[model samples]
Target: MSLLREAERCIANQGSHATLNALITTLQHLGPWLERVRDADTRRTQGTSKSAVDGRLIAIKDNICTRDLPTTCASNALDKFTSPFNATAVQQLEEAGAIVAGKSNLDEFGMGSHSINSRFGPVRSLRRNRDGESLSAGGSSGGSAVAVATAQCYAALGTDTGGSVRLPAAYTGTVGFKPSYGLISRWGVVAYANSLDTVGIIGKDVSSVREVFGVVNRPDSRDPTSLSSFTRSRIDSHLRSPALAARATSPLKIGVPLEYNISELSPSVLRAWSRSLAYMRRQGHTIHPVSLPTTTLALSAYYVLAPAEASSNLAKYDGVRYGTRSEGPNSATFPSGYLYASTRGVGFGSEVKRRILLGAFSLSADAMDNYFIQAQRVRRLVQHDFDAVFRAHQPIASGQPETNTNPEKDAVDVLICPTAPSSPPRISSLMDHNPRASPLDAYMNDVFTVPASLAGLPAISVPVTVESTIDSRDADLAGIQVIGQYGDDSLVLKVAELLDGRHL
Candidate 1:
C-alpha cells in the first residue's frame, strides 16, 4: 500500500469526502501522484514496471476524456474543456498504472437521475439523512459512485448512457461495471447517446470491477463503436465452447426477471430482491422465473432511443463549434443565429435542457415517425428481449442460429434485477425546488436501469445488504442488477462475483 501511502490514502479520502462533491478535477498537487510513484519506483528498480493498475487511485467520470483533468461534463457546456488527449478509456487507465484521481462530478451531459443536474453542485451521499440531509448521489455516475463510495478513488470512470453507471452503482454502494456496449472505447467519451455510450467501471469490488474490466477491454481503432478483432475473436471463441466449458463448471442458471418484480420494490428493495434470490438458491444456483417481455417497453424505449441519440449527439454542442458561447442581444445582428440560440440557451443543464428538448422533439419532422421510428422499433424489441432470455450465444448475433437451448424451461445465465427501485433518494427528494419534484419523478430512476441500457447488455451494480434490525448504519443497501448476454461480458463479471458473496 505504499505508492506513497496510496497517494496519502487517496489524499485522505479526498479530504474526508469534502462534502461529497465527489471531485471535479483534483490532485491539484501530489505532484502528479508523486510523479507516478517515482515512475513506479524507477520501473521497479529497472526490471521494468509490471502494472495491473499499479498505483491505482482512479475517479474520472466528469464525462471521460482527461488529458490532465477538466473534462467538465458537469457542463456549462464543457466549462473550460481541457482534454487534448487521453480517453481511450483514459488512455487505458493511464497505461494501467491508473492515477488520475479527479474529474468526477456529472449529470449535465450525462443527464441526471439525481446528481442534481450539476454545473458543479449536487453529488452528495455517503448516506446521511437523520436530517443530516445529503442523499441522492445516484446520478450520471454520481460523482463516480461517490468517489468509489467515499474512498475517493480506487476505481471510477463512469459513462453508461441510461442508468448512468448502474444507477450510480446502485445509489452509491459501489461496484457498477456496464461494459459490453462496444466493450469500452468511445474514443474519449463525451457524446451522451451516440448509440448509448458505455465505458463504465466504478469499483470497490467484483474484483475491482474485474480489474478495470481487464484493462479497457481492448480493440479500439479510434472507436467506431469498437468491438472488432473479428468481434473480439468471436467473443473469445464463444467463451471457449464445449457448451461454454461445461456451463463454466455448472450450477448457474440464475435468471429471475419476471419483469423485475416491480411494485416499485422498496420493502428494503423487496428484501434485497428476496434475499438475492434466497442467496442464489442457497448457492446451488437455479432461479429461472424468466420473461423479459420487452421489460415494460424498456423505459419507453429508453426515453425514445436515448433522446434520439441525444438529439444527434448534442448537435455538436452548437455555439459555433461546441458550446459555451453566449453573448446576447443577437450578437451582432444574428451572428450565426444568435450563437446557436444563445449557446444552447446559456449552456445547457435543466436536465441538459430537458434532454435537448427531448432529443429535439424526437428528432423532429413531425416527431420522426411517432417518436424516432417508434424508438427504433422499441430498440429492436429490447434486443429481442435479451436475445430471448440469455443462455449465452449473442456475440452480436452474427450468422444468427444459436438460441434454441432449453436447459430447463427457457434458458438463462445471467439477469438478477433490482438495481434501483428504492434506496438513496432524499437529496431533498430529488430537488428541482421540490414541491414534489417531477421530471417524471426523475425518470422513475431509470426503471431498473433502462433494460440493460436498452440491451447493449452487460451490466452490474452489486451493493446488496438488507437483513436489517435497522442501525447497521440504517441498513437496507439494495442495488442488485447483473444482466449480460451480448458478449456475455465474462458472464457478467462472473455473475457479479456470484452475487457479491464475492464468489463463495
Candidate 2:
C-alpha cells in the first residue's frame, strides 16, 4: 500500500476524513519526496515496534519548517520561501518513519482564531454532516485539523499558541493535543509568541496523537528553551508514582471553572457541557466547581503579552536576513530601511500587522509600565490560580520553594470546559462581518482557550454530539476541552478518552 492509497482508504471508510482537493499543487511543491512516498508500500505499514511510525503519512503545518517544502506560515511574506532545515519536530517525525505528506494551511503566523486569515484560503471543516453546509474547521491550525479529520494524513502537526490545535480539533471532530510547554522542541517552527507557542498534534484519535507525541517529546539541545532532562524525568517520576497511577485507575475529580461559563457560550455548547459533566458523574468521577478569578483577565493579558513577544520576534524580518525583500522602484532613492517597512506592510496580513502594531505599542516605554507589566503580573496570577486548583504540584526548580502551598486544598485533578463559546461560523460571515466589528470580537474566540495557554498547561479538545437545524446538519460536532496541570498531558488525554467513551 502507498501513502495516498492508505489515505484514500481512510477517507472512504471515515465519512469526515481529509479531502485532498488541492493536493496536486502541494505534490508539485514537494517534488520527488512526495512521489517516493506515494509509490512506496513499505511506508504504509503500521506496527508497535521501533518502526511503528515508519512509512506513516503525516501533514506538517505551514509554520513548521520542512527542508523539502515551502514553510509559508500561511503568509505571503514567505510564499516563495523553502526552509533549509527541518523543524526539530519534523525531523523527529521523519526519523520515527513518518513520511512528510505536505504543508497544511494556517492563520497567518498562527494569529487568527478562525482559518480566515490564511493567505492560501480558509480551511473548511470536514464535518459536512447531512446539511451540506460548509463550516469553519477552527484555526489557526484549521488546515491541520481538516487534514487529519478527512484522512488526508494519518496525523498532522500544528503550532498552538492559544487554542489553535484544540479549537480546530473540536470543529473538525478530531483529536487535538497540546502537550506541556517545552516538552517538544520549537526549533524550526516559525515563532508566534516564543513563550506561549507549542507544537501540537492532531489525529483521528487519542491513541494516534499519543503515538506521535511519544516520538517527538524528547528534549532537543538545539532549542535553548527546551525542558531539561532532569525536569522531564522529575515529571515522569511523579506521574508514574503509585499514588498517581492508582488515582488514574479510579474515578478522577474533574473541575468546572466557574469563570468559563460566560454569557457568549451558545445554548448548544452549554447543553453539551452539561451532558458531558453528567456522563462523567455517571461514570463515578467527582465534579467540583473551582474558581479561577484571574481567568477573566487572561484574554486581555494574552493579547498584551503575545503581541509584545510577536513584535520582538518578528523584528528579524526586516527585508534583510530572512523573508522576501522588496527593492523599491528606485534602489538609488529608496534605501534599506525604507524598503523594509513597505515590504513588511505589503507582505503581512491585516491580522498579523494588527498584532505586530499592538505588540510594538505595548512594549513602548509609555505603555510598558502600565499595560505590559500589568499583563505579565496578571499572567502569573492566572498560573497561580490553576496551580491552586489542580491536585498535583508543579515541580519547582531545586532550592525554589513550592508556590502552590494550598495544593491539598484544591478540588480536582483536571478542569473541563467548552473549547469554544460557540459553534463554527460561516467563513463568509466571519470575513464580511467580523473584520468590520471590533477586533475584540475576533479575540473572543480564544476566551475559553487562552487561560490554559497562559498557564502553560496541557489541554485537549474532543468533539461531542449536538443537535442542529442549519441545513439539517445533525449538529455534527461540539468541543469539550480537558485541561490538566502543567506536565500532566497523559492524564488529560486519558480523561478525554474516558469522556469520549473510547476508554470505557
Using TM-score as the measure, the top candidate is 2
- What TM-score does candidate 1 reach? 0.36
lDDT of 2 by residue, 313-391 (tens): 8888766677766666432245533647767876788999999999999999999999999999999999889888877
TM-score of each: 0.36, 0.90
Give residue 2's lDDT in candidate 1 (0 to 100).
55
| Candidate 1 clash pair list | 25-103
How much lDDT does candidate 2 score? 0.80
Question: Model 2 clash pairs?
Answer: 17-149, 17-150, 17-151, 18-150, 18-151, 43-55
Top candidate by lDDT: 2
Give the per-residue lDDT of model 1 (tens digit) for 361-425.
87889978997888788878878877777776676565766543445467887878788888887
